[model samples]
Target chain A: MMKTKTKIPEYTSPLIEQIYEGISQNTFDFVANRMQLALRISEAIKAKNWSQKQFAEMMGKRPSEVSRWLSGTHNFTTDTLWHIEQVLDIRLLAETNQESTPIFEADRLRKFVLQEVNNALEKYLSSRKLVSA
Target chain B: MKFKIVKLSRFSGNKSSLYSVIIDGEQETLFDTFIRNNVSENLHEVEQIFATLNSIGKKVGANDIFFRKKKEGKAGDGVEAIYDYPSAKLRLYCIRYGSVTLVLGDGGEKKVRAWQDDEQLSKAANEMIKISQILTQAIRDGDLSWDGNDFVGQFEFNDNDEDED
Candidate 1:
């Protein structure tokens, strides 16, 4: 039998390699979240049948400014985000109940992990008893 | 590799927000050189700039105000990446060939307050201009094609044009 070899393409630049190497998971998340926000804004405008110009007018900004905003690199401030939410009448970021939602979620996750661990331990003990018997 | 235009950002008004030339050749790209010399040196300010550029590359249409026109002219003018840090004065220069094509040039830490005062940046700008001229000629001679958005060509030093500087 003959083995076929696969050739791997090398990147042309060390700069590109360094840049790629420098990018962390946090940077990926940050870039992804920004893109998601841009997509959401565009989708909301499309759903309302609003053109870029119309959306700009609604937002009280120029079409060019709105265009930049939707370009996926706008460092959106919290105030600007709130304004966009108000004008678009859609929640862009996920809103959670202020009270005990996060705490409840953490508690639930802990309980689920604990349950799984107990189940695994029980299975191990039952197998040991069987082996001894 | 050849000269390919990667739209760093969407079109705004007469031109796209940013365009970085993807120059891949048998030899290393100018971008590659720029990254290697500066990135490995590990200067804090320069690292931030590269990191920002990396983040921008990751995002769709990652154009921001940090990229500004080095010269006040039409689409095919000089452009530079304005270092975003308030205290840092480094400029990454390039050449904008069309509505959305930029050839990356060498960049350096800004020494003088005025861009003109900085000899390094001026030299970088000159190099970019020369590449832009070569690209323009290549396109005119049918060696390169501008398809309304990007300049498509086989950018080899050995191949088409004889007018090498």
Candidate 2:
């Protein structure tokens, strides 16, 4: 009996490797993760019913450049990130738990109180006018 | 000073009840006065809105005044000035201004229209301006912090076999 040898295909994961390499080179494991971040942003743009052309116009770039970004073919620069944040009108990266837990809670509570006060005032004024007439 | 509400039904849709005031021969848009009077705890919202508007090619002149293009009018002329805070979906427009403010709402149609005669517009505008000032300072001073995602840290996992060698 003769034994047959099987050939295995050689595959290099360029995208995966790029992400790994980018992560390894970072001082604190930040930056260079733009490829993954871009995917999230692209998803958000679609969810918001915004087109690449509109986003490009907002960023003052041509539609082709935006196309490249969405395709993940282009490495994003810091300037581009800033522009994206501006155009999307969202904070892509916020300090992780930077504020004390209590402080954050207090801020939330304050907002609620203010909203209630405004609502009450509005209601009172409306009723007062109705009564006068 | 004595004040009167100039009906703005001609400009905005019938659903919108818009009015302005005339004071001392000067017109102060109600929306503008509201922003000028209100104080905001979170200036971040205001800053973000202004930046978004500015990025979208909205015209902003000195004093942070944003002008919206008139549907049909001559160049450099607009029927309204809109201050939009996109984060809150809150927008205020100045139809006319004098001693009393005549504010209109294009964003929060129902809420803003209901408070056409209230002083809330002035308070909200003031708060918005305060927030804008803080945002401007943050940008100018570079006090804005970048998200942690920008910095990457690495760890090496050494195998026991490699250590034995």
Candidate 3:
């Protein structure tokens, strides 16, 4: 039954085109974030050498519920994510403001550099105006 | 019943190949049918599922955690399901060949708790399982062969299920 390579049909249609582009960007972002959270939870569980069921017990959720949560479509609340972080001791969300974290200092430094650059540009513009005068 | 295994171009990427089945006499693929039926009531769930599919097809590899993993996977024939979990409003069944290839099948609102409880959902899942078996047999018999990204020796599937198109 082996024959020469045949072309597989590309199943693109108008409806598919509409659906692919029709969905809102917000929906896509929500899905991507959910997937990332699910992956992070799975990874944390794996790193701890614990099965999903064990992780579920630690999180005080049913194994079935945990499985559903990892299906990449869960509308996770901030409370649930925080709980997961506590149970797994894994950081899923970045700190908005934490003085001890290196990111905070780096962000501060970046802001200072931007302000300095703006001041230097203002001085250069004033000098140029005076020279033209 | 007869169907054609068609690869979806928009979702296909370097990471994985997304496929769909077009029943004989149908104008669009099974995945299209799922989207058309649920566009009005379950638009958000539909969009989320589409986003997940697009991600799996492009950026992220088709990891098992992203899906129900195996509604019929105990058979070990790649029969799986995908949906925006917790909502469980709609479920799309498919056949996965490892993480590289997937054949999207049509789905219906899983109003009941189990697919077996709802006749329509059962039919959708079962149809994909039948397709999975047929495709596996075709590869074994040399009617279809792996051509890198997808099976390319033949697109035709002479499945004998008495299901409606």
On lDDT, the leading prediction is: 3
- Model 1 over residues A51-93: C-alpha lDDT tens digits? 9899999888998787667755578888888999998898976
What TM-score, computed on C-alpha atoms, does each candidate reach?
0.54, 0.25, 0.75
Local accuracy by lDDT, each model: 0.54, 0.37, 0.76
How displaced is residue A15 in candidate 1, in Å? 5.3
Tell how far residue A29 is off in model 3, in angstroms: 1.5
How would you class the docking of model 1?
incorrect
User: What's the lDDT for candidate 1?
Assistant: 0.54
DockQ of 3: 0.25
Question: Which docking class does model 2 fall in?
Answer: incorrect
* Candidate 1 Cα misplacement greater than 4 A, ranges: A1-10, A31-75, A87-91, A98-133, B1-27, B40-59, B62-66, B70-75, B78-88, B95-102, B146-152, B157-165
Candidate that beats the other on TM-score, 1 or 3, i.e. the better one: 3
Error of 2 at A37 (Å): 22
Better of 1 and 2 by DockQ: 1
Greater lDDT among 1 and 3 belongs to: 3
Q: Model 2 over residues A44-93: C-alpha lDDT tens digits?
A: 68777988788778778898666557532255677777778877776766
RMSD of each: 13.7, 28.5, 12.4
Check candidate 1 and list the clashing pairs: B1-B24
Give the 10-residue window scoring lowest on summed lDDT in candidate 3 chain A.
A124-133
Report the C-alpha lDDT of model 3 over B1-165, residue by residue, as the tens digit.
Answer: 688888889988876799999888998888988877776566657666778887788766577877666454356756788745664588888887777788899888978877777887888888887888888887787777766677678777665632423
